[model samples]
Target: MTFSIKDDSPLVSVITPSYNCSAYIKETIDTVLDQSYPNWEMIIVDDHSQDDSVQVIQSYEAMDSRIRLIPLANNVGAARARNIAIKEARGDYIAFLDSDDLWLPTKLDEQVEFMKSGNLAFSFTSYSLIDEQGHSLAIEVKAPQTVDYKHLIGNTTIGCLTVMLDRKQIKHIEMPDIQPEDTALWLSLLRNGYQAHGLPKILSKYRIVSNSTSRNKWKAAYRYWKLLRVQEKLNIVEANFYFTKYAYNAYNKSRGLQPVSIQNGGK
Candidate 1:
């Protein structure tokens, strides 16, 4: 069913956690500014950035009332920064977009309708990967139409940038202060019997930064292992089983197996 967003659409609060992302933050903000859905507030929480990121974001905040900036006193990690923005969110829906990523113009418009049509609490859309230069790598990670806890434990198909959550359904939202915090949050929601439905549209671009912790394979693997053992409390055998599946998916996502049309500037 086709749905058109109206002028009186429910407000969406975009949560953005920023660190030293001055280089790509402007582009990220531009994508949100270009969104077809205008009823949204982008709350950018800067984690004590040493660079000019705070100044850059504050400039936009001054121009638009919907764009807000919260500069932290200390350099908290992304997990904490995100939580701060979450606390300040005053919208019916919540969306996450990292400072380095980009979103399609129709992302929020289409995703809001997708959630409403199914009465979904949590939902995510397909997203493509791009280089730090914002050039599409022709690698896209597709999302299944629906995912439950059983299927999600072995697969990290959801991307933070493409996620949209209905605040009305989820009364309390929080993320553990740990590596792979987004994954932990997803698992928690799914474990509570909340099914995450996906709109299979490439609505966002996840930028692969060279210096990002995700680029370090061993570290990333260790983080996932810890999440499984400590947070999920899975036994050794079960941990290894799920870890293998997660690793396999991560490997495929790194390659061009799920290839899409290559575009410049994350178009």
Candidate 2:
């Protein structure tokens, strides 16, 4: 499926699945409000957060009509929260950003332009890694020149914060109930022969908190292994090979080797 951009294109829906993310919720909302592109709505789904996340989102919604807050009655996981947000989304395009991440002002503008120009169904941009304090960690990522089912297995090179998709094509596809929902969605798209394009510019900030899930090496490894099994069902050997690399990198990183830069390394 292909789409051409019109001057009166429908607004893009940016879905943010929030849990107990009080620490970074304010900054996340601010970043979305600061987007250079004006034709977008921010749908923030609070997954029954125990923290002040709901209040924060409510305040934002009170200030901007475009920012809508939906409070889930139950504490469902991120996958379910995102699925709910997508179901409620009313836009021609869909974009995702985690509550702990921040987007550069031009993020939506750049990505929307790329998608329209390339006639792409989905696309993602590069991003920089920041510490919990929002300090640059001197880590930046450039996505592969091209992405395929095999290349995505071991490493989730595309940050979830950077992804944008055409709602017309992806609205019917749902995020799987998997450990890593982002990777699962990407795999589904790849399996269905939907190509993903990357704009090699750092358009967002990915926060790495001390107690974040990425820090839990053991759980991460287990999840990677499970994702590998799913990829195996699709007969993707490259996914399995990359999963091994991912596991090794996670282990090495936990031991203090820089996971992003160690050559020929997998966590």
Candidate 3:
């Protein structure tokens, strides 16, 4: 069930797109470099951070040949920055991690093994939420049984930092120029008849600081609606369906109900 490759093992490329994430960039790099799996390269794309993010990345790049830093002249956004990194990746499989997240030592190894076992084109893993100080926030997401277009509409269960994809399967596709870029990418792949399975293991740490994107619930809701309109090209009825789900989840989350799981059984 392993992916077919000429070499004994295919290289895994890890992409980290950063912007003003200096506070947590070092931990992110350390997590990747400490992985048990060996065949991997880390590509850090800096979106013209006004902070010391570039300097931090450069320092790491100097220490490890496996690390490469690509700095943009101007600040675009995470979606575009990730697209740039994807274009420059040379490995047979591409994995993504945000600058603020950390991967467990076996993150890559376990994911690669599961992908090989399942012959999956792309996959993600469950993750635990951590604060800026690396303290566990006791937040966890139960992995969905499967990932498909229908399940993705109401919620984005796939953690971007935990996702890995076959480079050959999606070489032509690029990240969409939209907020919540990861969601858009997953939708595109699913719409194109590609299947992405999720590993039930919690192999990554998702940092949930006060200023993190997901904390801005209103903005996330808006972006989710915008993504539905932009990518799915859904009519008003379908768009409202998605919006209502997102709004309800946001409301429930604000009230302290465990984050809604985006399962497919709600049809």
CA lDDT, every prediction?
0.88, 0.79, 0.82
Model 3 reaches what TM-score against the true structure?
0.90
lDDT tens digits, residues 1-267, model 3? 122343556789998899899999999999988888878889999999999999989998988878999999998888888889988899888999999999999998898888888878988888887878999877776566677777677765678888999877776757888878888899889888888788888899888789877789788877888888877788788788777776775565344344465543322
Top candidate (TM-score): 1
Kindly give the stretch of ten consecutive residues in candidate 1 with the minimal lDDT sum.
258-267
lDDT computed for candidate 3: 0.82
Against the true structure, candidate 1 has what lDDT? 0.88
Runs in model 1 with CA error above 4 Å? 1-7, 258-267
Point to the candidate with the largest lDDT. 1
TM-score per prediction, in order, is 0.93, 0.88, 0.90
Clashing pairs in 1: none
Error of 1 at 91 (Å): 0.7
* Best-first order by TM-score: 1, 3, 2
Ranked by TM-score, the better of candidates 1 and 3 is: 1
Model 3 Cα displacement at 186 (Å)? 0.3
Better of 1 and 2 by TM-score: 1
User: In angstroms, how far off is 247's CA in candidate 3?
Assistant: 3.3
